[model samples]
Target: MKNAMPRTLDRLLASFLQCGTWAACALIGAGLFVGTKVLTAGVALFILLPVLRVVLMLAVFARRRDYLYVTIAATVLAVIAAGCVIGIRLGPLAG
Candidate 1:
């Protein structure tokens, strides 16, 4: 367990780039939900990314039952949520 944080952090950092992957998936899902507009798609994606991340994180934690991993994953999800909120608020105006 002592090495879990470092291992988790490393895994997270590697997949941090995959945030874009989640974002893209989200945008596509959102577009499907709200109709196919660039702004709406962007907004949908912004919201979806964090949700997907949270769901995936929860699943991973559930499977492993690692408290440290869960905490780190939750932190990442929170950061994603903050970014999504800011982006959603600004997205329409930017359009």
Candidate 2:
């Protein structure tokens, strides 16, 4: 049971990332022939992958009663959120 959890989590995360990457790539390719909207969607998904992964890890850690990891993941997520908020606020001026 103990060993199974980590294996399951590993498999799940790996599969999720693989599928997400493939989908994003496909969208980007299609967008090349299609339009900017599809390309933007693909780019957004690509950028969001890491955030989604962190969220997944946070959920798993909470489920496993790993408070330490949960806190760490939560902190990382908060930082990401803060950065996003700042970026949005700064807008084009940020660059």
Candidate 3:
């Protein structure tokens, strides 16, 4: 009974994981925003695209279990890299 579950530890782990996830997302978003072909498009894509990708990947993670955390982490990193390669441009979003 004593080892049934460690509520405090569970809470701590959850917090750490969530914080890490959010930070990863924010960094990727910022990088993507800065590096897009169009500044305005980049900003919009940075904010929205990752959110969508994360949501979709969440289900995949749930099924795979082991890959969830790693996938999320890798995704954040990919977004950052993608941002850098996107470049810059001008159009309707600039207004």
Q: What is the C-alpha RMSD of each candidate to the true structure, in Å?
A: 7.1, 1.6, 11.0
Error of 1 at 37 (Å): 8.9
The TM-score, computed over Cα atoms with residue i paired to residue i, of candidate 1 is 0.41
Highest lDDT: give the candidate number.
2
Candidate 3, residues 1-95: lDDT per residue as tens digits? 32533464356456655665566566656667665434444455446655555554555445546475657756776776676555433334456
Cα lDDT computed for each candidate against the true fold: 0.70, 0.95, 0.55
TM-scores for all predictions: 0.41, 0.86, 0.33
Assess the local accuracy of residue 18 in candidate 3 as a C-alpha lDDT between 0 and 100.
Answer: 68
Model 2 lDDT per residue over 33-73, tens place: 99999999999999999999999999999999989999999
Q: After superposition, how far is residue 44 of candidate 3 from its true place, in Å?
A: 23
The positional error of residue 26 in candidate 1, measured at the CA in angstroms, is: 15
lDDT, model 1: 0.70
Query: Mind sharing the TM-score for model 3?
Result: 0.33
With a 3 Å backbone cut-off (N, CA, C), the pairs that clash in candidate 2 are none
Question: Where is the poorest 10-residue window by lDDT in model 3?
Answer: 1-10
Model 3 error, position 76 (Å):
24
Q: After superposition, how far is residue 24 of candidate 1 from its true place, in Å?
A: 9.8
